[model samples]
Target: MTALPYRPCAGIMLIDRHGRAFVGQRMDSTLEAWQMPQGGIDPGEDPLAAATRELWEETGVASDMVEFIAAPDQEFFYDLPEDLIGKVWKGKWRGQRQRWFLFRFLGEDGDIDIATPHPEFRSWRWIDPAELPRLVVPFKRALYEAVLAAFRPYLNTQIGIEAVSQSDRPR
Candidate 1:
């Protein structure tokens, strides 16, 4: 496992107006693990495009329904547990190297429909950003923590005494 390359991937942390992040339970998993939208970055594909594509594939949230926020200047990585190293992803990769994006969901809940043509989630909901790590599988806790740390500033900020809206964000 140590010798295998990490799979390239993109992850999305969709934020609601209340500063919560979207998470979903994997359809095939028996564990109580819930995770943010993420999936492999196809060969030669831009990570941002992959994030947008994966968002629709997993949660039925289209790019137009969300506004791009921030992405870490660096990538995050996590390795599969020993038992999973040789069994997942055709044993080709040891883990994933992810470029995570934060996007503000612009539409109402009705705009999201997880029952896609190729659904990856069983159920989904918005969660407090601070609770992310505890909700995910143990192996991904660190990655989630790092993501929170990186995106914390933008989640909600006070420039003085006023709250900024999406319109105030730079183009």
Candidate 2:
């Protein structure tokens, strides 16, 4: 069989004032499937704009409350496990090719309301970037790792703190 094409998508790494990344637990998941806010890029939409829109859709954090940090030099791609190949995204996609952006959250915690017009996550929290790759579902781990690496330099820039290694969790 021919390989399915990857869906074009954008991902957000929303960081709070403390430099912790935002992760959400999927409502459809039975396991601890936490992930950064992400979604498909609409036709003719810019990836960074899609990232901002996805953040609002998934976290209720508006574009005004966030500032762009940086994007990876290249998009990262991930394939779903064989069991999921023909079951997800209406089987139109093998997985996703994502353009990731880091955004610094400027609003207070009260500004976030995950109960958007359409909700995807059941619960959400701020986590250390190093914990991100471990918390995400297994198939998406490498993607998260690449995101972490790409966004590591800017994690402390907004907070004006010492830089943290992408692979090292804070003590």
Candidate 3:
């Protein structure tokens, strides 16, 4: 029997003082949607460590500047593209089991630099939390919603007027 494949991953949701979150547009890809900075957990690396590394590698934010808020209790799954499925990584499963993190950005907006070597994102911007649902990939929307809900309490309390009256505003 073939062994089952499982890979661990980590992601960071960096929130700013204006109650906005950083979202990156994938570089060199046709799909133009945006998402949080994330990457696979290296062998023997803890989830938090991996999240910190990924945040810096992808967004140019120093690991020490952001405060960790929470980690998701569950993992998210998605299928890999068929063309590169087994060719890249030696795993039977194509997707990853991810642990997500929420962080408050302690640095200014000028600190971000997506143009570093081997850049993961082509561009990034501070976007309103309410706009995340429409900008993220559909399959990952639920997980993003859950992560946002989990970190809601720690997010900056100064919400905009529009978000206040909406009953369905993310927690």
Candidate 4:
């Protein structure tokens, strides 16, 4: 029996000041839903570093404009179709164990440029946090919910401030 191969990865759930989270629409494909920016960790690369790199690569947001808001978390045990196992990438049966980070975007929204040399997302948007569970892939819905719940305090703080500020502004 062949041993199952596993890969370790990392990702970021970028939240903006308006209490919205970033969701990237996959390009050049038929998928209907969007997802967070994520990628595989290079050998010897730290999970945080990988998450930062992926955020920049996929969303055009630099690490300098974002702050690390939490520690690592894991989502494991995803099974790929048998035919796609070796064909997509050289791996056996095991799935990715990912560490996710939550980042607060400090840069202007216009700074996002997915049209870089190697684009991952064709388009991106800031969506409400409550909508994330329905937008992400079904297999990843639970993980997304967990991440959102873990980061809810930070999100709520920002949201409250925004509401107060908006109400205080002149009409």
Better of 2 and 4 by lDDT: 2
lDDT of 3 at 134: 81
Instruction: Give the C-alpha miss distance for residue 50 in model 1, angstroms.
Output: 0.5
lDDT of 1 by residue, 1-171 (tens): 799999999999998877878899999899999999999999989898999999999888889998887777699999999999878899999999999888888889888888999888899998888899999999999999999998887776322112336554322
**Which pairs of residues clash in candidate 3, taking residues 3 or more apart in a chain or in different chains?**
none
Per-residue C-alpha lDDT of model 2 across residues 1-171, encoded as one tens digit per residue: 147899999998888878888899998889989999999999999887888889999999999998766776688999998898888888899889999877778999899898988999999998888899899999999999888887776766445334434544211
- TM-scores vs. true structure, each candidate: 0.91, 0.90, 0.79, 0.80
Flag the better candidate by TM-score, 1 or 2. 1
Best by lDDT: 1
Model 2: colliding residue pairs? none
Candidate-wise lDDT, in order: 0.87, 0.84, 0.74, 0.72
Q: Which should have the higher lDDT, number 1 or number 4?
A: 1
Which candidate leads in TM-score?
1
Off by over 4 Å in 1: 157-171
Candidate 1 accuracy as TM-score:
0.91
Model 4 ranges off by over 4 Å: 1-3, 73-77, 81-84, 91-93, 157-171
Q: Write the per-residue lDDT of candidate 3 for residues 134-159, one digit (tens) a residue.
A: 88876667767777776666566475
How far residue 156's Cα lies from its native spot in candidate 2, in Å, is 3.2
TM-score, cand. 4: 0.80
Pick the winner on lDDT between candidates 2 and 3.
2
